[model samples]
Target: MSKKMGLGKGLQALIPSYEDENKKTLRNITVADIKPNPKQPRQEMDKQKLQELADSIKEHGVVQPIVVREVPDGGYQLIAGERRWRACQLVNMDTIPAVVTEYTNIQAAEVALIENLQRENLNPLEEAVAYQSLINEFGLTQEELSKRVGKSRSYVANMLRLLALPDDVLALLSSGQISNGHARALLALDTDEKKIVAANEIIKKQLSVRETEKLVKELLQNKENRKKKNERAPEMEDLKDQLQGVFGTKVQIKTNSKGTGKLEIEFYNDDDLSRILEILLDDNSHVSRETN
Candidate 1:
């Protein structure tokens, strides 16, 4: 299914019990009689969202029953209907209608996740967590996930990487304090302190994502310069490494801390310089070195 049709996309158009001639009556099944699927991709929901769903359920009856798998323990394991289950509970419904199916753990998880994604129901965090779960729980690669969900591998990879963010940033994203683009800007920062500072600057300055990207680049460049200055002649040192690689000769760099540095491009005379120059400026490429 296309990711555009994520879990909630055509859910209303799905054959609801009301529309099915052979649909089971709205009957109450014991809450204890239902079991959570161990293979369920979505393990948690935001309390605020849950409450909101519950309020909606209180107003309109559960339009759909949950899908479940019968367990030997007399209860039914949830298959692909968590949203309906949660909403029903919010309205204090003791028993909910369920259609029990027999499926392996892997099959159940795949179905559940795909159904949710197709309906466009999972939020970004939930989607990431679900994708991560599908990988960790099922041993699927980003490429495989992309194939399954009809998304590009890069899209799957990037979404999965969102989980690498710190908790504070994740909270900001979940709470709508920052947009995904802003979070992407923070990801450019190499350290938590720097990222947090950038995040603060973003909120304070009301910078757009593009502006944040530019600001982060400038800050990173400044950081690199500070690091180089602390190490003295870092540009020459790096140049030595590069030139050595290019000319196959031991290159040396000499510098004095009095705001002066020298690039000792040691070479075996004329032929070495040719190779060095070629490596330095390959295919009209301009390699410029700067201290700051």
Candidate 2:
């Protein structure tokens, strides 16, 4: 991991926290008029958690306002504090207190990503998807993204790799059934079938992340061993070549682990068979020695 750069400079500072929102000059705007940010990286909000916050707001009221930008036509668009905005709505508030600002499209997206990251609101899968979306939509490199979000480059890169997982594994991750560590360890497996099998075992056995890593390592080692055993030796092919030359016919050799098997020589006609027999009898091959 790169050295911890405090999430406090440049674009990182653009994202407003609840405390920061409290400091800005607040404006009370109709909650219904304020629209959700199109660039918002958060896909969904937890209903139960939203209700808990709503309960807190009902008693104490909205202590910190949400931040918004003026729309070209009219009204405002949310830049951050979506959860606070939603909670106010749960309480049937007509207008929400907000701090108005101006932001470009890319700036809005950057703030949205950083805001969620700062609050730890996104799950592992959502965080990864958001990273990919920002990179795709705005053409930002992982290193650039890391600096923008104040994360290490490897942290951004590793998060992006979680997308390569199978749909089943992704579902497990999205639903909070498995952790990011478990999902990452499973990627070492090459086949979806093996990954799914491992995932099931993870859930069933209640395996920890370290246990999952060990399991996947063993599976990969076994796969490599099987591949080595299935490969044929070079000398086997050379022996088949010698047999074919001696008989002047198409020849094949098959053997078991015990080195006991059959040698096949193909002949189309009686003349061909006679020709092959003549060569075998004249040569110092095992068949001729046995006959003598």
Misplaced by over 4 Å in model 2 are: 1-12, 15-25, 233-292
Expressed as tens digits, the lDDT of each residue in 1-292 for candidate 1 is 2122232233332223444556553346776677776665554567888788788778876666777766776877887778778777667778777755555665567667777777666666667887888888789988877766667888888888778778877777776677778887778789887887888788889899999999999999888776767776556667777666655778676655345666666567788788777766777654445656
Q: Give the TM-score of candidate 1.
A: 0.62
Output the TM-score of candidate 2.
0.74
Q: Tell me the lDDT of model 1 at 260.
A: 66
Query: Model 2, range 1-292, lDDT digits (tens) per residue?
Result: 2233334364335734435644564679998988998777777688999999999988998987787888888989898899899998899988888877666676677777788887888888889998898899889999888887878899999999999999999989988889999999999999999999999999999999999999999999888765654665465676777777777789988776454789899999999999888877874665321111
Instruction: Summing lDDT over every window of 10 consecutive residues in candidate 2, give the lowest-scoring window.
Output: 283-292
Top-TM-score candidate index? 2
Local error of candidate 1 at residue 141 (angstroms): 1.4
Best by lDDT: 2
